[model samples]
Target: MEVVFERVEGRRYRVGVRRSGRHDTGPDVPPRVGVGAPVGDVPHDLVHLAIEEALGLRLGIFGQVAAGGDLGGFFTPPPADRSPLRDKRRSQRLARAGRSDTGLSESLAACVGHDGRLRGADELLTPAELGRVQRRLTALVDAWRATPPGGELVVTWPEHLTVRRGVLPSD
Candidate 1:
């Protein structure tokens, strides 16, 4: 999977996740999944969950991010050009939140109910399941924060973006 985080405007960003190995031979090709939102809209605790869903990670009984131990990597910066506009916008958002804008990437994730489908960077989960995911993600974020300043956050993908499972929560 290749996740592209594009700066839309201000602190808003558009995240597109595409399956690798697919040829974009035509103009009608579409990404496997996509999501977008401003940094402050979603609760920080749920960001990883949102990214997993946007990347089609929870279609199975177990999501890949939960299965894998590299959730901290998602906080890594994308391998994209950083424009002055994006930097300034991100800095402004961080400053408003009383956090240092320098050498930090502000990220937020949440799930939105759209057309009877959950969208954005979160998965639909039961209260118990949500709590479990929250704890896991919080630990990951803490590790990410502990990384040396100027270190990059890189999001790596599993060979398959989605897997099949016999059982998962319907709600």
Candidate 2:
């Protein structure tokens, strides 16, 4: 799969994916999936969730930075204590905070659909705290491409900042 990260404006970027074929030129061509956001607009929580779901790396925000900012530093979580009361309390807290563990899945569903059309382009992230999140995302993407779990995955950021197919890695 080819993933193109195109700058739309300022720090805003749009991610597009194509499952097959080389980059083509045409107005009618549509990516298999697409999502757009400013670099600062991408949530740290969501990035962490996506890394966990897509790469099976459970390096939580705190631990990720402490481990020298690499995927190899990820470690398995300790087994949770099987307590029904604790589970109930945790669920209630999450509900109150309007957060869910399925953040990655829900975000993907909102952005990319079965028809591959883009959606939810207006969701704005909270202002970045210290630019650490952006750095974290870059590191995560580099690690993902280095050892893609499923197959060859390519991610590119266009120089001209247009929503066109980026140069493939093989090019």
Scored by lDDT, the top model is 1
* Clashes per candidate, residues 3 or more apart or on different chains: 5, 0
lDDT of 1 by residue, 1-171 (tens): 543333333333444334343421101112211233322432232354333443344322113222211122322232355444543343333233323211121222324221112233233455554455455455444444444433322233444543222122220
* Model 2 alpha-carbon miss at residue 88, Å: 2.2
The alpha-carbon deviation from the true structure for residue 105 of candidate 2, after best TM-score superposition, in angstroms, is 13
Clashing pairs in 1: 50-121, 50-122, 76-153, 76-154, 77-153
Model 2: per-residue Cα lDDT at residue 135: 45
| Model 2 score (lDDT) | 0.32
**Residue 98 Cα positional deviation in candidate 2, in Å, after optimal superposition:** 5.8
How many backbone overlaps does candidate 2 show?
0
Question: TM-scores across all candidates?
Answer: 0.30, 0.27
